[model samples]
Target: MGGQTAPLVWGADAEGGAPYVFYHRESGELVGFEVDLARALERRLGRPIVFRQYDFKRLVDGLERGDLDLVMNGLEVTPDRARRVRFTRPYYVFRLQLVVRKGESRCGDLACCVKAAARIGTLENSAASRLLADLGAVALLYDSQVTPFEDLQLGRLDALLLDVPIVRAFLPHWPDLVAVEPPIPGRGFYAIAVRKEDEALAAQLDEALAFLAATGELRAILERWGLWDQGQEELLPPGFSGSLAVSQGSSPPAGASPRRLLTLALLAKAALVTVALSLASMGLAVLTGLGVAVARLYGPGWLQAGALVYVEFFRGVPVLLLLYLLYFGLPAAWAALTGTPGLYISPFWTAVVGLGLTYAAYEAEIYRAALQAIPPTQWEAAASLGLSPKQTFVHVVLPQALRLVLPPSTSDFVALFKDTSLAGTITVVELAKQYQIISTSGADFRVLVEAGLITACLYLFMSVPVGHLARRWERRLASAR
Candidate 1:
């Protein structure tokens, strides 16, 4: 709502990668076609461009929240999107490009790729993903555009379907990869998106676009980026003449009830996965923590030092980094060591082990403190009863320590449940990931809200009961004492 003289704030995801917006390899400067376009728009509009980094999936939400004036990171013009935001005249036209390893022969074209049921990877919630779903091909969705290509090279993905600009920018770096020709049919237009209510801003942006297109400045920018083609010929002449009205013809289908129910069912199923993962991870944490605590407390000096190092190291590193290391780094390291190409662990197990190992460091501290809290009198009493040191520790000290640790352990479990969301980065679609997918593909803002609310409720439903149980146990223990 600032005056016309204020800097125009635009949001984009650099992680979406080159030709759109990414760091240059040599200079490390932020460079892309969109960056150039933003500069041109700034010149035409008489305002400086202020760039803001956003996650690609959440860019629209950022716009809705008034965090950005527009989003220009290769954003596509689609009827569904138009219903939510006003788009300027299309700036660039791109087609989906299919890519496979150089020697791949099973699928030469889109149809052959689909017919072969190739395991294809694409940006999540994208046009290509919807196309793959409609064609019944196995589509793996990723947050970052670059990671999918990495997976393809690692033999984890058979091929990748992405925009032509991305393929063009990245293909050279990957010598073993080649884009399939011709580019997939149908065209998508990239345009700057402004919030639906910003009519004044949208109009101003349209005017700037028209001026850029008319003066041939836009074409020059695209050409410099190697994006200018026949598509721009169709777009430039008619600049800014398009209607702004949201088209009713492209509204979501009448099967809302069924779709909602199915979405709910999928969320519920993902909630179960979250529960199973949390439980398994917590179990491992508890067992590993007890061993570390026992070693630090009672083992030889070398063993105690080792346990201290383990606790300090894991506790210092973030769990998300741990998951990434286990899921992506470990496999790469293993392949380098063994010369085996496909030495990857399943995402679910990788998440389990990563989360388990991370929380164990915290759990060790809790167990160590609880053990120390046990009074010296208890050990003495057990010894007076003719019990051996091991038996005294187990029958007397351990039982009291369990009571002391229960409340904290229960709290840790609840925290661990929420931390499971981080697993999505490694492609384990727990409740949070499921909600993200549903919200992204949903027809309207209402769907985003409803899916979000349901996801939150599911998390509470899983976590609240455990908290209540712990509180009840605390009360019982206080009364008994």
Candidate 2:
């Protein structure tokens, strides 16, 4: 959408992992088949190719928004997607691969996994995920390509169905994992996707792809990444053996409206999860925080120091890192300590505990401040009433501090509600993740916008009442005073 002289901006997800667009560990540079192909396309078009990172699910939305000229990641050719954007000629052919832990025997093949209703992991909105759905296997969707393999090794997933390229790239690093022979049935094509109206850009990209294929440059790129094979032959001369009907402007099929309704329902359900997670986390935060605050203010010197360390350490670490540690690291640590192999924690509770612990530190500080804000005369008054230390603290100091901290506590609860989106990283599939999944599956940009608006409104619906209650309580306390 930029001027002719502007760089051709392409979108990709570096977290998509190797053989696609991913960061090179040793060199600390982005490198992959797509990176090489983009460079080749730049040379062919005589324009600079600029790479922009995005979540793989949002790449199409970026294209629709005119933020990117095209997306060249491992975007597949699908009818739902075809209705949204024009795809370049198929650049690479890929097949779904089923992976299992090295000694797994219960579900060795796709059929076996399907028959067993085994829990299979795959990328959200991917062909493999759809296949799992059709086959009646329980599908666990992930945002990152490499995470399924980790879950497979951890026994969290019974099997993993993903693109062959991803399996090839990651299997070397996971010796305990193996791909089933003869990958899943059917093949998919990876291509560049452009906005539907970008006919000129699409033509230029197709021309460049034809040239690359003819001159063996495309094969060289794929081969360099260990991705070239007989499947790639289909992309050679006479160009794009696959059907080109997707390039034509096509509307979503009739009765697609129900899908939007279903999407809304999913979002609603996820919003409930968000509310429950946030409320539980806040409750835990309040209780733990009160204890820590009391320890820091009134406990023995050693206990106070310990409470201080807890607050500083939790406050310093990021919540996302904490979620990852609690979800993945904790089990591994438990295994090492107790010589147990499968010490797993469910994603929901892990999110609750991780969020609770991280926010407890902030809650501790808030309560501490509110407790300190109480005047010395209040304690003297309680003492003059012949109240014991514990009774005075409980009956007078605690109640006043609770009232003072109400507004800030409400603010933290709202913040924690939004922070629940981070739970998606651990595969909790709360409101934000539901929006992403719906956006990826929908055929229209309007659908994306609508889903996003609905998500935002739902968040507000849950958070606004807490704030109103806090204000009402503040006013009542003032009136009573």
lDDT of candidates 1 onward, in order: 0.78, 0.79
- For candidate 1, the TM-score is 0.53
* lDDT (Cα, tens digit) per residue for candidate 2, span 96-188: 989898888877899999888788999999999888788778999987655576678889999999898877776765778888998876799
TM-score for each candidate, following the candidate numbering: 0.53, 0.53
TM-score of 2: 0.53
